[model samples]
Target chain A: MARREVSVLFFLALLCKAIAIRSQPSTIDASFCLSWRLAVETNNELPWRTVPNKCSQYVEDYLIHGQYERDLELIMEQALDYVNGISIVGDGKDAWILDVDDTCISNIYYYKSKNYGCDPYDPAAFRAWAMRGWCTAVPPILKLFNKLIDNEFKVILLTGRDKEILGQVTIDNLHNQGFIGYERLIMRTNIYKGQSAVTYKSNIRKNLEDEGYRIWGNVGDQWSDLQGYSFGNRTFKLPNPMYFVP
Target chain B: MARREVSVLFFLALLCKAIAIRSQPSTIDASFCLSWRLAVETNNELPWRTVPNKCSQYVEDYLIHGQYERDLELIMEQALDYVNGISIVGDGKDAWILDVDDTCISNIYYYKSKNYGCDPYDPAAFRAWAMRGWCTAVPPILKLFNKLIDNEFKVILLTGRDKEILGQVTIDNLHNQGFIGYERLIMRTNIYKGQSAVTYKSNIRKNLEDEGYRIWGNVGDQWSDLQGYSFGNRTFKLPNPMYFVP
Candidate 1:
């Protein structure tokens, strides 16, 4: 009887270990996160893995336990300090570029089910999720944006989503989530279709500059959102190993 | 004794089955191939997988058995048919844009070592591989490029490789691989740094058009190489499931 009990316990232990491996975040923590950020900066993409992929247990814990929120608070505090340092030269011409997904809104719920980078991106499913328009505001960024608006800085929203398909819905989604009163909401048109996010966003900033707007700050979760020509005076990035947009 | 013998045979069979599963090609059949081609046409990325990945067993077999070459021959034949139907104008200003990697040269041997997309891209290793300058010609496209030149279509070579680092080496590599006599070889410059492949390439084509060159044909393995404003009259694409560039 004791031997049988032992066998049962062993089997249960093995099953628990398997579940733990699958459920744990795979890419979080200081060293791996640093390497990952560097790789992303250098234009290197990570391959999807069935086992121990990029998203880590710490990231899940961080999100669920409010550590992610704390990090954002700290980042926004720094951004505010920088904004305070700069003086506006033009009337309402000092603009700040903001990326939509994961910057202003949280996709944590969608990514929680997708196993981060383990599963391939399903566009139809992603579009369905987006259309639901239920994503909540990322509190820190929302606060910063509101602060910027109150301080008379022009806030411009940019995203890689198609203007023809997702434009109206995205606007509604943002407005419903408490993101309102922006200078312009730029979505990729057919002319800029197939452009890398960097190129599309960079060109838009250049156009804004040409129109005599002074870009003062830029912020996004992806480095692609920040790196490029005409990149404003300062840039802020949030952590996101859930998915990479090239 | 009989029970022990039976257990041993079952174990051996199970081991054999496991080996077969690991070695089998997953995604290289006709239907998947067609779907993959379509996905690549509309979007430019495919995440890596360990099991039944995008690269099919049929593709491996095709590459090894020279079926890939035969398929290329068939595709080039169609391209030739299309080219014959079109009329060229503008003196020596009629141009054909040719992408260097994959469309003009095969990185088959390099990819084979990395299990296709199973491994993440290694730039240091890739640069070392490229510096050897030993990549062979993708014979069918080479033939088409040469044919276009012979037909008085000014062939233009374009690549995403950085000019500061790989310019001379790439030129020599192309020349050594029998890819000679092009009207221009444009490599990405520091001025275009941080630009997406689409933007960098599209701007180059637009510049050529501005200079009075009429683009008649474009060919590449990546959609980013073909899609954008100021595109040529026609475009041809080759198959590549190995890696993606944004």
Candidate 2:
């Protein structure tokens, strides 16, 4: 009986060692993943197709945990503070620009199936998912949208989603998700087909200014959305570590 | 004896409860502080004075631990990769701009005493520290500097440090830290006394361009160092959550 007990203790020790060995790489990966996400968000690391395979679990945990929401909440608070300070011209030309996907509504559900963007982007799969219009409002951003409307700012919904395909469903999805009363829902037309997001968005913004719209604020999850000419007076970036548009 | 044992157990449970209660706020603060740091790093949260009091320990741990070094390593890796891809003109006009403080040399030793920037900025104290010239080379950045020098790229040290007060000491600090063979060390002069960092750096970059220097890469810890006119072909930001420059 004593021999059996000693063997059991030895087995337990081996098991602990195995568990430690298994966890050690992940522990290192987790720290590197955090740095990678920061680099992505800061636009230092750009033109990436997807999250690193090693960071799949890290990104999943970051999104599943309350940290993602908390980050958005802080951004929302700051945006509201900025808006409160704005003296709206009341000329019906005071505008605020918000990116659609991952800004107005979350693609978390879709990304969950895609390993939180660890898998390479499948455009057709994403289009099918968008056509389904299953995205829900990012709660704090929905609040920001409503606040913008209440403040009488012309909230333009600027997105890179193709107008020929996803436009109608996007409108329905946004309206269903409490993003009503927005001034315009602008999507990519065939004319802007091959242009990069920065070029496309910049030209659109230039047009808005040309039409006498005073863009007060811009909010986006992707840096491409906030960059380029006429990028408004203040730009707020929401966190989206899952993928990069440009 | 049983009564005494029961009393001791009750006391132990109360002690555990007290410890849990004491740790609860810090746990919450830790999560929020992480989000805060991410926001700051991404340039979403801006125009801040110092590190939040709640984030003091968080920032301290991030610096003291190996995470800060790992982050810098990743940035250095990316910067080197970018530098490798550049086609140098070989006309002695290829240049890279690097910010001095917190970029080429680290001020962690100084920030350590200042509660990792939880304390408010005391310009007099910071200037005194600068005058002492005790900063060390950020190892990865030093490597990048040497690489640029080896590649015959002119390394320009552009800093917001006052030229009249700390210029010589800054040069000595850089040299002692092995940051040798740089093209120029540009510091703030009295003429730019009241200008913001963005304006000051932009004007200098403009002057450099006017002088026939092709700015290929810019590296700095603060966004102000990378923003504004003539921001180079690429800009890399190193992590510094301790303080804000603009």
Candidate 3:
């Protein structure tokens, strides 16, 4: 073949190779992101700060799309089914532990601006967002909460939000979102500062148990919220591929 | 219109309605099955018997089509990364606990006949399958296993299999599949017969700890295999959407 022909052939070959390389990582990355999310959900993967850089789009789409809501719905259904099966003693001490962020209320609106947790967690920025008190109720959880109240079970809102800065706003947000009649709203006070989420939440739960309350059900979007001592009789983990609390 | 024409139109409407009704359940069922599997993997839902009757095809496809294996590969990768991070003491007591059935060897072929866990677990048939010792190694897990051995970590095969029935076959199968090198194999014996899987496995783990083995890592498909006392320094849960042990 002539030199020109050979050059053309080499160029075409390079283009094909380039296309192959370009197309490959997306598929591999997509699969890896999926597995990463599952591993995170099942608590196999831990202590992740932010979503994988490659999975930002995937995570964003999952959150905005119908799958996230459907997942939440299924969890709520299961939780309600479990609660219904229990014979509530009709005592005020039968309590349900619910995490505030991503459990009862969602910060997805704020996280949307942060690439759906692709950005590292900024404490000040997140606190600023929370201070706005603009977070909405997670619908399925709101439904479950009301059902628990209707069933005469005490509903406790337990969170890692700072009691000093976020206390009033958190209360206002909950009330605005129809999360009324909760038995208590517990937040991180000064004494629990700097403690890991697992330790802080566990200590609070221990206090509730100490007060003669039976925590029958616990629900949260983070594994840290569900793990540790006094983790309740049954715990439900809602999907949050966003960020790890610890 | 004539009566005959009216009848034809009515029949067509009825046929359309029938088709709509027939098509809707599958879509809903598919979503529910996906959520159900996730819930089971995350330990949100528990004590399930067989795969939901409507989800037979979904479960079968997940098991056979590459997704399940991909999930397994991700877990194995995470486990290896975790294992690599640990600084093993020169002492021979650094141990890795692994559950045998789905973690080391897969029962996919047997489950294929059982509708991918859509059928109720039949102990006699399953034991017969196990006795044949035709199980294949889960490739990712076997890789992790060999890597652990290479790293000088003591690998312990802790399983829920009956010692009297499956001891020799289990050993032969492991050897045939290249699971060689340093280890101990602990299986269920008479004393643990009546106990639940959590109790049984926990007891065995406690025994190993009492013997001065530090369980730096634990990997299992069933939650029961990983829960309870002496769970380990860190635990990795492999994907198992099949039957629940307890």
Q: Determine the TM-score of chain B of model 3.
A: 0.88
Estimate TM-scores for all models.
Answer: 0.45, 0.92, 0.89
Q: Candidate 2, residues A126-168: lDDT per residue as tens digits?
A: 9999999999999999999999999999999999999999988
The model with the greatest lDDT is 2
Tens digits of per-residue lDDT, candidate 1, A211-243, equal 988988898887678866787877777756567
List, in order, the clash count of every candidate structure.
8, 0, 0
All candidates: interface RMSD: 17.5, 6.4, 12.4
- Model 3, B1-246: lDDT tens per residue? 556655755665565555445434236666678778888898887778888888888788678867788888878888888988999996999999999998899898999899889899999999999999999999999999999999999999998899999999999998998889947999899999989999999999998999999999999999998898999999999988878898
lDDT of 2 at A173: 98
Task: Work out how many backbone clashes candidate 1 has.
Answer: 8
DockQ of each: 0.02, 0.39, 0.22
lDDT of 1 by residue, B1-246 (tens): 356555754665565455544443232244344334323322312222331355445446546655456546655766787678768874889899999988898888887777765577888888888888889998899889888877888999999988888888899989988888899999999999999888999999999999999988888877678766676876665656566676
Say which candidate scores most in TM-score: 2
Pairs that collide in candidate 1 are: A25-A56, A25-A57, A26-A55, A26-A56, A27-A54, A27-A55, A27-A56, B28-B56
Q: Looking at candidate 2, what TM-score does chain B attain? A: 0.90
